[model samples]
Target: MSEKILFVFEGEKTEHVIARNFISHYIQKENKTVIKISFCGEIYQLYKKMSEDDFGIEFVDLFPLLQERDENLKKYKRDDFSQIYLFFDYDPHATNASNSILNELLDVFCQETEKGKLFVSYPMVESIRCYNGIEDNFMDLLINIDEVAYFKQTVNSYAHKKYNNVPQWTINIWSEVIDLHCRKANLIVHSKNDFPEREVPQDLILTKQIEHENKSNNVIVISAFPLMLLSHYGEKTASILQNLA
Candidate 1:
């Protein structure tokens, strides 16, 4: 039987796009469908995009607060679901937005169904950095990223220095991470919209909360094991997804 799973996150529409692809790839099951729900704005558009694919998912825009409530006790119970998954980043936002979301999930779960399980994937930046062989002290790795003028140059440099060539998946992940980081830098350097106070020094985040602060640019770290489990072991991933669903 198919299960209903909820994925809540604090990113824009693109995050959902990547998540759907990731979940579809990870589950490796075409028949056992999942319902992808989000709280991000413009749910209708996401629903349209989700419908276009044969990923076997029904996407919805749920209220962001659902994560905090218990699935069993709520007035509108989602008892069909075996589990609920919450994906968010512990980025350097003063608002404690991630914790607030977590609290909501806790409130619901404790009140509704003790049987329900919650999975939290966080610090996406560290996840990507780890995949790309970037050190935890990523400030040091910045030199390498900045020096890679071209892929060929990177490869040549890798050969000269005997640095391992990054895997294709790692490269893709790094591309996203780097793009996010650069964009965040631009945001700080250019505008003062979401970030009002002076941007915290990168050195502080890089040295102490490198894993924690990656979310500042939407680059929260995630466990590569989840990705690997979904991609390499198709049959097992299917079983896991089925159970979770």
Candidate 2:
């Protein structure tokens, strides 16, 4: 039996890199654990990757509901796992349908858990752009998460007209974003003892073991963004799940 997680993403070019990196790191570093990944919503290439990769993790890039339904139909039902982790960005929409999707997933996981299903969920977290640390002289560090036009305008005004390559700007900006994302994830997983008390479920029974096996999984949600956090600890998270099972 292997541990699994459902990886949900917006599936942009940047996101694709993150997913691949996560899978690569986990598979190489942690042999004890197994990951089953699935992608959903407005994505195509990820489905291609999922098909091409021989890794054990499942990947699907369809509507979230359909993806979950497919997982349920598989040999591993919703109750078969130890945890279900949802990853998504906040979208500006009238209905905020992401929450609805998340809730449905939780409902299924919870239903199965109550029926002696071992799975649990950590819901209602998001990944958005924060300041990437490339502040000084780094004209390429464009903030692409939100306010895209504004971010580009700022980049254009950096007074460095000599460098006009779009790819350079994208790379620089993405690198900074990726680095910040990794830093945040590290802090969250590393700082379990210092987290402020909350009324909501702050930790799960699975947390301790997951931390022991893969310390990065315990970090705050931000670090997991752009999938760097997962790539760093994917195997470890899987190992913990496998060990627990």
Candidate 3:
């Protein structure tokens, strides 16, 4: 049997397009693993949907005080997927006001970390574009930065306008960019803290308030997509990435 992995992304268009292309290429090359991708609109919407479906937790239960049932919830079985991953951005909800909801979602996700992973990109998904052999400059750009402004001026500037049309080519460029970034930095394993204010604590512990929470080793938090990609595909993939670069 082939290994099955399901990815829930925050964006419907760009993420879905990129994931489809990347997974298609990956499947063609490996021919053993199967991947599924879905978009759940925004991060908050995705969180609500995953909580209700994957964990069987209701929206009211997510926030006992707030009574809002305007949205419909879906049902999900654990056996539906071998692994589940949530990809989201850290910029919009990094402030103190949004931290409560963020922490709540994190608590829910951390419950099944062994079977579910949370992959967050700082600022936004476009930050991955910064990985084109300029590790020092990329690192410098991240220091003491205004998340919104930086994203607009720098990250969004590199956003591929034709991403939806030619996702394979876009991802190929990303792979090469990451390969160059890793080689230039001389790092075998990239640190998860490469993104500012987005580190998953090594000693993350769950509180007792959540009844459904469980101790799990499944959650794999990452700041850079290249690290995850290279690690998953191995050094041979790196050789291919270099040639593409």
Candidate 4:
């Protein structure tokens, strides 16, 4: 059997679109690996689903009884996947319930860092679009506008609208968009490794390490997903991000 890689995302919109497109392109070229993508609404929902499916306990029930439950669940080890990634964003405006949910999810992911990896985009998933080395400029353009509003107006809406217009928006078109915007800013888009990192929890294992100049700069940290693809597939991943305009 081929090596199975699973990606679970936080939503069905942009995250799903990017993950699905990247996985589809990746598997077509890489016959040795099988990729599967799933969306479970949010980070907490993903934790809840994984816990119940893999350990037979809800997130709430797992914490207090973790010692006993972990011992029992060891016998039911889930070793089918070669790699499992959870894609989420660190939204500053998240609800109280969502914040609490992410705290629990972070706790569980920290414990299973070897088996489960979390790829969190700071601010929002739109950060991935901003990863083309022009983030500072792009963010500056959004200074007067909210990030979500800018994303919806620029990246998200543009993709969907273009998709509708053509009946099929190929990966080449996606590449064109990236190249056009990145080149316009005189930016040389690099891979995930080149991006700067913001501080996360000390206990959390970030797959890729990056540094920030200061506390106030808007930084995009992609710990897995696209970075994993880039590491394994190289230029193919970059091709998907953008090509020369």
Candidate 5:
């Protein structure tokens, strides 16, 4: 039977494009199918409307939510997918940029096999490939909250010319991106200046970034796309990332 993975994306174009490159390069399963669904609104808005009895985000079923916003998801069932992954941005400028809300959402959606795993791209979805042409050592890269709303424009102006079309990225280019983000995730979470040795939970990364934001008011530059690839594909992808170093 073919393994089916459902990708729920907030930034439809960017997330799907980046995911396509990674999926095409790293996913070797001959019988694997990827079903993509895009959410048109901010995740915080979803949290606000869906809070439960205790004003806590207890139940979040992405299938129904996706169906509510997109008419195409009416036929898909939750059980049909082997795994479910969600990709969203950390838009701190939003009116509902509360740490508690994001933390609760992260806690509830922690399991990929069950409820689904949520991966957040710090600041915005463009962080996955917002590598500036001049800054090679971007592990310490941090962007202020005030400037976050304009991040997509910054990426358009500063990111390497080649990254303008992420969907066209070759395997070698994808390998480089995966390698860069894997190491950056380690630095952001564990404060280690090396590649991640083991899988670090997305919630942990979120917690740390939240703490950092409280203190410094700047969010680290890390993307959920590469980490998602590393988590799902494991060492098959890691081996390629490691060799690139």
Candidate 6:
């Protein structure tokens, strides 16, 4: 049987393009069939909808949302996917943004075998390119609420040229980037400076981000897609990225 994987994303453009390339380059070889859908809104909106009185704690029926937003997903049942993943931005600047809501959503959806696994990009998705070099301190790239609106341009201007555009990135580029982001995530979760050896729970990353934001009113820049790779592919993802194109 073909293993089906579902990606529910926040944006219709960049997030979709980046993730498709990463999965196509890295995971599809394992015979996983991929399906992509866009939530078409910020994370807070999904929380409000999910927390509505009718939805309750059962809070897990994304196929309906996917079918409503994308014509292609309508025919597929929830059971069709062997694994499901969600990518959304931690747009704390958003009007409805609340740490509590985000925390609840993260806790609820923490398992891929169950509800789904979620990875959050700080401020926005452009964070994937927020790295400048292998040796540079990526944690230095933090954004306050004021900078959130202009972060895409900021990353475009300051990120390493090799990682600036989706079209220009080869499988080689994908592996290199996957290596960078996963290592950066390890720094956030475990205070480690090496590649992750185990899963870093999404809720823990959020807790770390919240602590930083509370102290400085700025979130450390990070991307969702690359971190998602760590969970989906596990520790081998770091080592495989070291060896792959």
> TM-scores of the models, in the given order?
0.38, 0.36, 0.54, 0.50, 0.90, 0.94
Q: What is the model-wide C-alpha lDDT for candidate 3?
A: 0.44
- Model 1: per-residue Cα lDDT over 128-211, one tens digit each: 333233333332233222222233333343322212222323323433433334333323334322221232222223333343
Once fitted onto the true fold, the runs of candidate 3 whose alpha carbons sit more than 4 angstroms away are 32-39, 45-77, 93-115, 131-133, 143-153, 156-172, 180-224, 230-245
Q: Write the per-residue lDDT of candidate 3 for residues 1-245, one digit (tens) a residue.
A: 66555565666556565566566655435544444444544556655554565545433232121112212113334464455556676554333324345556665554222445555554456555543334445433431223343654554354345322335466566564555434422321233323211222211311211111223211111133543354355556555655644
Of the candidates shown, which would achieve the greatest TM-score relative to the real structure?
A: 6
Q: List the candidate numbers ranked by TM-score, top first.
A: 6, 5, 3, 4, 1, 2
Off-target runs (Cα >4 Å) in candidate 1 are 28-30, 41-77, 97-245
The full ranking of all candidates by lDDT, starting with the best, is: 6, 5, 3, 4, 1, 2
Compared with the true structure, all predictions reach lDDT values of 0.36, 0.34, 0.44, 0.43, 0.77, 0.81
- Candidate 5, 104: how far from true, in Å? 0.6
**Candidate 1: global Cα-lDDT?**
0.36
How many clashing pairs does model 3 include?
4
Which lDDT tens digits does candidate 6 get at residues 164-215?
Answer: 8876789887777777777777887887878887777788888889888889
Candidate 5: which stretches are off by over 4 Å? 28-30, 52-56, 133-136, 240-245
Q: What CA RMSD would you report for each candidate? A: 14.9, 13.2, 9.6, 8.7, 2.4, 1.6
Which regions in candidate 2 have their CA more than 4 angstroms from the true location? 10-17, 26-28, 32-39, 42-73, 93-179, 182-223, 226-245
What is the lDDT for 112 in model 3?
Answer: 22
Predicted candidate 2 versus true structure: per-residue lDDT over 99-192, tens digit per residue = 3343333233332113211112111121223232333322112223234324334434542443323234343444444444433333344543
Deviation from native of the Cα of residue 241 in model 3, angstroms: 5.7
- Index of the highest-lDDT prediction: 6
- Give the winner by TM-score: 4 or 6: 6
Residue 234 alpha-carbon offset, candidate 3, angstroms: 7.6
Q: Which pairs clash inside model 5? A: none
Q: Lowest lDDT 10-mer window, candidate 2? A: 116-125
